[model samples]
Target: MATTLLLAGLMLAQSAPAITVEAQPGLDQVGYQALSAGRPDLAIERISADPVMSASDPAALINLGTAYARTGDRTAALARYKAALTSRDRYDLELADGRWLDSRAAARLAILMLERGKALALR
Candidate 1:
């Protein structure tokens, strides 16, 4: 009985499951389409449901910020944009410097910021 109990304890310990974290879905082409189709609220809802969108993905954060901005939610837009800037990856800087980042995306962000009256001087 003692041996069986010991073996059972060992087996239980060995069988411990590994924890796995799921990724957010984040905004995709489909989401962008929805947003462009005058469905900002729906786009926001769908994008927000992405499991992988942590506070890190600038693209996702930017999209979310844009969605909020479209809805006239300046507070949420600013917060999301600030978060995106904070999480701005090497790619973002590269893009800003007009190096490796997508020209369209970089230009778009710059134009958007300027239009929004953000302090572009600091960037």
Candidate 2:
């Protein structure tokens, strides 16, 4: 978990705004569409329900993190980010502004980490 968080932190070190989630077609696309529609719960359900997505889609993983963070469950959000880092592909996320609960997903997580000043995931 620490390794995943560390990698995400390192990737985020670039400081770019990741507002648009790079979504693939199928369940992943559905998930992104759901989130864009302001139905994070449905987004989560759609993405998490797909077995292939849980294993392969980095975008879906990031979207899941966004959903969790949006719903105010930082723990869940951190877990989703950790899972995203496990993907062999290094996906660069340039999120769209205000398209998510916060302006940027990773930025929001960073801010939440700062405000809370804790979380093993943030370490």
Candidate 3:
């Protein structure tokens, strides 16, 4: 029974789709690191501190949205995601482990996942 359960768990893990968030070169690394470390409050504080940088950068918006989502602030998260979704700027956003995606596409995916109650999949 143990072997069977272990095999099943492995299979499930392997089959789960990998989730990725958009990254921006000019974004605040400290804020990004906070978000990645699962410290949403810290991420929000650091990101918000740089209003100039975070204001016009869609990538920063996405990161803020992700942080808000992590904190269960769906309204704030959705607002940020929506703002990012309308941006015309393009970026070589990192999607997965060594994989890249367009920033706009990443924002769309994040919004979809959040709306579908899969906000936990985002990070």
All-Cα superposition RMSD per candidate: 19.9, 10.2, 11.0
Candidate 1 lDDT score at position 57: 52
Q: Please report, as a residue range, the 10-residue window in candidate 3 with the lowest summed lDDT.
A: 1-10
lDDT to native, each model: 0.41, 0.47, 0.56
Between the candidate structures 1 and 3, which one is better when assessed by lDDT? 3
Q: Which stretches of candidate 3 lie over 4 Å from their true place?
A: 1-30, 97-99, 120-123
Best-matching candidate per lDDT = 3
Clashes of 3: 0
Cα lDDT of model 3 by residue, 23-46, tens digit = 333444425556555567897897
Q: Summing lDDT over every window of 10 consecutive residues in candidate 2, give the lowest-scoring window.
A: 1-10
List model 1 lDDT by residue over 1-123, tens digit each: 010000000011111211111122232421344444445577578667864653555555555665565666767766766665666442322322234433224324533663554311101
Model 2 clash pairs? 18-94, 18-95, 19-94, 19-95, 19-96, 20-95, 20-96
Off by over 4 Å in 2: 1-18, 22-30, 92-123
Question: How many residue pairs clash in all the candidates, one count each?
Answer: 8, 7, 0
Who is ahead in TM-score, 1 or 3?
Answer: 3
34 in model 2: Cα distance from truth in Å? 1.2
